[model samples]
Target: MSNGPTKRAADWAETTGFARLDAEAFPDFLPGWVWLVGAGPGAPGLMSLLCYHAMQQCDVVVYDALVNPDILRWVKVGAELEYAGKRGGKPSPTQRDITLRLIELAQAGKRVLRLKGGDPFMFGRGGEECQNLAGAGVPFRIVPGITAGVGGLAYAGMPATHRDTNHSVIFLTGHDASGKMPANVNWPAVAKASPVIVMYMAVKHLGEIAAALIAGGRKADDPVTIVSNASMPHQQVASTTLEQAGAFVAAQEPPTPAIVVVGHASDWRSVLDWYAPALRENPIG
Candidate 1:
């Protein structure tokens, strides 16, 4: 990795409130090296120090659709910010194309930052990006962030795992690359084993997925909550049972960009709810 900016370090660092961070400890984003970073679940406050520092130094940042645009304000001046964002049921850049762009930028001696929403490894296709980078012999670093499944749930006052609710939590995706229900999943097994179920991108197929879970032995009255626009100022939370979740969430305004949490732990949302008021009064600056 390169030793970072020479003359402008103090100016940018102090201005960004990043000068307090030790550069020696957190090296600058070097030219020709890509950093695959998670922007966390839609909240700038959830951004990690490493990811924030990388944003301050990167020359080109390729980001996903779910990443909050407000976070991009921190990127260094003159750096190219590319929207490589992919939204379900919408036209987006292909994975191969996105990876090739990263390679192209790095080869051109630009500090490439692949900024994704939530933890990149958690069904974010970050692993696929890393594989392509590795095969192309690109030097890169992975920076993890809070996933919507965990962090988003926290924002909605729903814990993924609680001693009374569950010991084992199941983290699964709602769809495959083709945007269909995942074929490999054994719904019955997941229904039987897991105490709490946290799903990503499940809103689209909530009806079918709910039926499968119900058929797999989950109770019809099981508490389920869908957290939409998670961790954002306009975030919304809707609750229903496993039997009615599909129809219940359909009534929600902005539905696709959501996280669905199932099992007993979801009940605590009413008691533990905190972000609702904060989002109303303060919002995130």
Candidate 2:
């Protein structure tokens, strides 16, 4: 008969206001539960519709370091904004404390929003927070956003997956809570298996990570791309090799908020860099 899939999608779009949303698509109603939303890498526009909705409706927002401040401006007036950021070498709230705060707020019958940077589940400690909420019997919903591994890499002209170089990609964090190279990571195995590696919050441990990868049989000359403030107007990209990344980054006085990507996919950045065009049109700075 008629195109059933197309018809269904159209109906869904109309029902959810997806087809009619304009620049300001804030929700008019609030759910009687908590929402854990990913704000994407850095660009406020990269935030999902559900995230925007939650911001508009939530009574309080508990956010992380990477969440763009501009996005928070969208929160309704009188909404409480609590900072729960965890920088590598800075004094910040503990993960347990943040989780407990969410539970407390949700229990108070407030529409709680736990806003994070990038995908909540991608090394964002969203799993632990969700587990805590579940244990406290607090109902919650998750809103996925673009992760830095993909969005940040895209800004630097690197793709996580390429048909020619890599069919799969591995995402990992460079350091653990102790601010050291993660001992739990099987570097040798990852070096041998993953053709593409994307790391978040790895700038501080670049030297150790590079050595580990080199020791794991990865080439010292393997391509690498370091992106800082990715997807934002102040974005900077530094291209080098595994052996030189540490020194190269140290030499440059680049701004903070960075991610590191190592693999053949980084080579594709030279030809496929489109973020410049996007940035020229919408300057975040």
Model 1 / residue 98 / CA error / Å: 0.4
Q: Once superposed on the true structure, which residue ranges of model 1 sit more than 4 Å away at CA? A: 1-19, 22-24, 278-280
What is the per-residue lDDT of model 1 for residues 4-74, given as tens digits with 9 covering 90 to 100?
77555655556545454554467768999999999899888898989988988899899999989999998
CA lDDT of 263 in candidate 2?
85
lDDT of 1 at 207: 82
* Count of backbone collisions in candidate 2: 0
Model 2 over residues 1-285: C-alpha lDDT tens digits? 774566555656666544555544354444447899999998888898888878878899999999999889989898999999999889988888898899888888899999999999999999998998889998888889999889888777787898999998988898898888899999888888888988888888887899889999999999888889999987888788999987887887456678888888877876988876555467442
* TM per prediction: 0.90, 0.88
- Root mean square deviation (Cα) for candidate 1: 5.3
lDDT of 2 at 22: 50
